[model samples]
Target: MATIQANDYLIKVDEPWTEFSKFVQSHHYSKIVILVDENTRKYCYNRVKGQLPFDHQIIEIKSGEDQKSISTCEFVWSQLLNNDCDRKSLVINMGGGVIGDLGGFCAASYMRGIDFIQIPTTLLSQVDASVGGKLGVDLKHFKNMVGVFKNPKMVWIQTEFLDSLPANELRSGYAEVVKHCLIADKKQWEEISKYDDLSQINQWTNIVVDSIKIKNKIVGADPFESGLRKILNFGHTLGHALESQLLETENRLLHGEAVAQGMILESMHSVNHGKLSQIEFEEIKSYIELIFGKLEKQRLDINDLIYISKKDKKNFAGAIKISTIDKIGSCIYDFNISPDEIKSLFSQSNFN
Candidate 1:
């Protein structure tokens, strides 16, 4: 079992579901709320059914990024209010990033605050979303425009849930794994890049463990995001913009897919700025595109992307700041770049 000790939060990785039951039994929560979407209810709820210690209420939202909004938060709040949920109630987020983010936001805003647990089902959530205390929903074309930092009491991750994920969904999560290696671990990058078929669930358990360790170390040092923790936003600047801009469009991009693309575009900036070599840039871009195929050729407006990117939470003083890597496994955060530079990078790709 891998355990991450945060300030007061604990992340248990690859642990048996029974541990969750015991933990629930140990607590005297007035009520329990398991937040899921239709997808999770169909593929995940049953896996943990036998291990739940309490009679919990299930709040199922529609499964997709479309449901991640204030309206969804309102619906969740209404559910809690209708059920007479008090501050003592525990909210268990039991799905991928959307569920975890929306559910956690709901829990944090309800009655000022309440305890919550993260049982991240998807690889993306298991390694990235669930660990970070950042919880929010998107606002218009902006990603995570409204959110807060509040740690869950515990985070339980089990790889068994991955067995039900579709191939595309599975690959989407792998992109986040690659991000972890690019920013924090060179050895991991070397190991993961050599293989093309990462479909095996057993093969990913350790990789997830290592990813969490890197994230937790960064988070632990800068829990409030005052400094070092921002490095975790490595590819997220453009990734969030791309994800949010395409969110309402017919051709939407998954979070990891957009991030994979973001890494490529940002690597170009790194090369142009002389921080990353053309060879390394091309190598990184090649591997990412090979694993996660290129995004569809969609005509995009450069100004639209710039506007959406300006909405990134990391931006300060009306300037766009992003985290970039000098080389594999070393990252620098909050580096400011020009919109012209971003446009130049986006121009390199087929978008627009």
Candidate 2:
């Protein structure tokens, strides 16, 4: 078991189920509620049920990006109210990014704030989403356009939950792992790039630990995302735009999938700005394509992508500011970009 102190809360990664059960039994919460989706309700809850000796309500929401909205938050809030939850009630968020984001928001808003614990199940959440205190839902086509900063009481991560993950979902989660490597650890990037298979959990545990440590250290320094923390937005500017644009379409991209593409595009931006070498840029792009595949068939509109990117949270005073890597594991932030630059990147035939 590894523990990292983030903000005012403690994050416990890969801890034993017995330790978690004991934690739940010892805490004197007035009431307990678990927020889960259809996927977690079926495949994840049983993995933790044996440890809970107290009666707790389960709030099940739909399991996708489409379901993450103000309406969903209303439903979750109403459930808590209907159940007579008070200021001291504890909420356990058990699922992936969607669950942790929306559920943490609900717990934060309920009674002006209450205690919530994060139990992130998927590989993506185990490393990224559950570590930081970013909680929110998407606003229309803008990703994370509405949110608040509220840390959970504690975060519990267990790798056993990964056993039932679908192959595509597994690959999707790897994108965040790759993002961590690119932004903070060059050696990890070199190590993970040669992997032909990700079928084993033990092979991934140390990587996950390293990723969480990177996030924890950054968040501890800049909790509200005012300065150095912006580096963490490395691939999110374009990645979030793509995720938002594709949400209602036939070819919806998972969070990590979009992020993988964003990393490639931003790495190319580094090349254009003379910060990264062309050879290193191609190597990054090629490795990403080999793992996450190419999006050439999508034929995305440059104008539409530009419009969405203009609305990215990273923009300052209506100017688009993006984060790019100067080298593997090292990032430079707050550079202005134009629509033509965005168009130029999208029009390139290289990614295909």
Candidate 3:
């Protein structure tokens, strides 16, 4: 919908490959690698394939949260080596968040680094992960624990790629959109919550752009997550812990699905710790449930979830670091909470 030029990289939205093609022509790369998981390779790859002016290598990995691992990175690295990739080579990440994370990490670590572009194929990557320059694979279920802050050369976002997604995937990405509104844009949040049917409102350009602007502004302000960027993790702290904890189970959650629920509990925490009113928390919780359905946990062990969360990279010393909102559309970061507090979150929830 719009072209946003950051301090270094450019994000092209819905304008197709005009800017991307121009940028590629200027950069004389030794090789080009297009990274995809099976899902995107089958669905999203062919769209961009015809538009690319140069011949490129297609590297496919399995698609899933579980596949976002060091082992996958090794496989990508091996493929890169087999294709004679070098520092001058380029990697085009052409999938959802997992591909963006894994592909970017591979490109960044390949011979100390190479140029890479993000062509985020799913809404999750499009609005959040792809633009942030945060790249890495998960370390043993703890989400994004082994990542780096390295921005891509550019990001190309097209809404058409989202068309291939199933409803659950779109619902997963909508969690971040909801998070964006909850943390930074109350007006948008109010509007989004009023949706009669989230899926029926087909045009997502405005919505995606809005979330991108909110996130990109925050990331630009605090590129390395030194301070302000942690607000972006508002729902992610407890959300990630729950996500990691459920991975061993059959009903493991999609990243955003977990974050959506995380927001529900974190909203409760906000009322307890910050200025968010009970009315506000209740409203937030109700809206989330209306959209994503209710929290359903049969045997979630709070202690194990806390143990997994303790490994979060954002945590400092022994205190669990998180971001909580003072109110809708605003947030504070570097907030620390105790394990007792987290257990209380579970105890207070409907699931417990």
Candidate 4:
């Protein structure tokens, strides 16, 4: 098992085919249940299933953000019940973020927590979502509203699976890579910006290693998210709110796209406050736009923005804290800005 160490955690990166067998041989798991989505079942299930050393049951959920809810969890729990899944049975989350999050939740709640392995298929899952151990489902239009930080037994990243991902999904995962670079590594940021195509396996491997290292460093320092971990939400506050709102509409924005726009506006906020130079701010915006394209404005009510902002997890003692950039590779947190100031930044963002 190839290993990457995080604070109090070790991510075991294994070849997809050998991952299940390795887990079964090493651990005394009673049974294995592989959780997949429609997309993964079509593109990845056979390859994964063929490699398992033992006969394992499969649980497939429909593909889409709408499936990321408590109702879906109920369905999965029912499946587990019908299949006689117990605490000793292992759950292998074999898809992207949605499957990983929902499956992890199911496993965590089943018999008060069971071991689960993350077999992340998409680039986004491989690099960011699967590593942090933040598992949850959305509630009342909020993203990751109900969750827990339960680490997976192992995380198997198959770079080869990325070949089946849609181009937009590839672009979506790039945002987190960009976020990692912006928050910590200048060299990494430069390398990612310079490399255009993600289809190259060698390039992707390097990117994944660097991104995981950056995230692991931050998560190690603040596993409980009491301090430094808050910095990781730099673009996510407005980004996630915007994403939550937009997800309800017909014109949906991917998570990375929303975060890309969030980074732009947050950087703009930084510039307005004189915390970041105008040149630095503009460069950040330009680079994101170049890769993810410009953010298209949706007809969202100002009140909705307020409502969603209030739902942000970072609000402490009734004050919303934001993470902003003073420059690339550097971040600041706990900056209390007024709601009106946030609105003003949103208006001036020119997201269209």
For every model shown, what is its TM-score relative to the native structure?
Answer: 0.90, 0.92, 0.91, 0.91
lDDT of 2 by residue, 1-352 (tens): 6887777887887777787767876878888999999889888997678777788999999998767798999999999999899998999999998999999998999899999999988888888887678899999865577889888989998777888777788888888888888888899889888875776345566777888888888777888778888988888888877877787788888878998898888888888889988988888888888888888635576688899999887898999989889988898899778888988987764654
Model 4 TM-score? 0.91
Ranking by lDDT: 3, 1, 2, 4
Instruction: Return the top candidate by TM-score.
Output: 2
Q: Please report, in order, the local distance difference test score of every candidate based on alpha carbons.
A: 0.86, 0.84, 0.86, 0.82
- Note the residue pairs that clash in candidate 2: none
Candidate 4: worst 10 consecutive residues by lDDT? 195-204
Clash totals, every prediction: 0, 0, 1, 0
Cα error of candidate 1 at position 146, Å: 3.1
Candidate 1 lDDT tens digits, 123-194: 989888867698999887455889998999999988888989887788888888998899989999998898
Give residue 301's error in model 4 in angstroms: 4.3
- After superposition, which runs of candidate 1 have C-alpha atoms over 4 Å from their true positions? 296-298, 349-352
Candidate 4 steric clashes: 0
Q: Which one wins by lDDT: 1 or 4?
A: 1
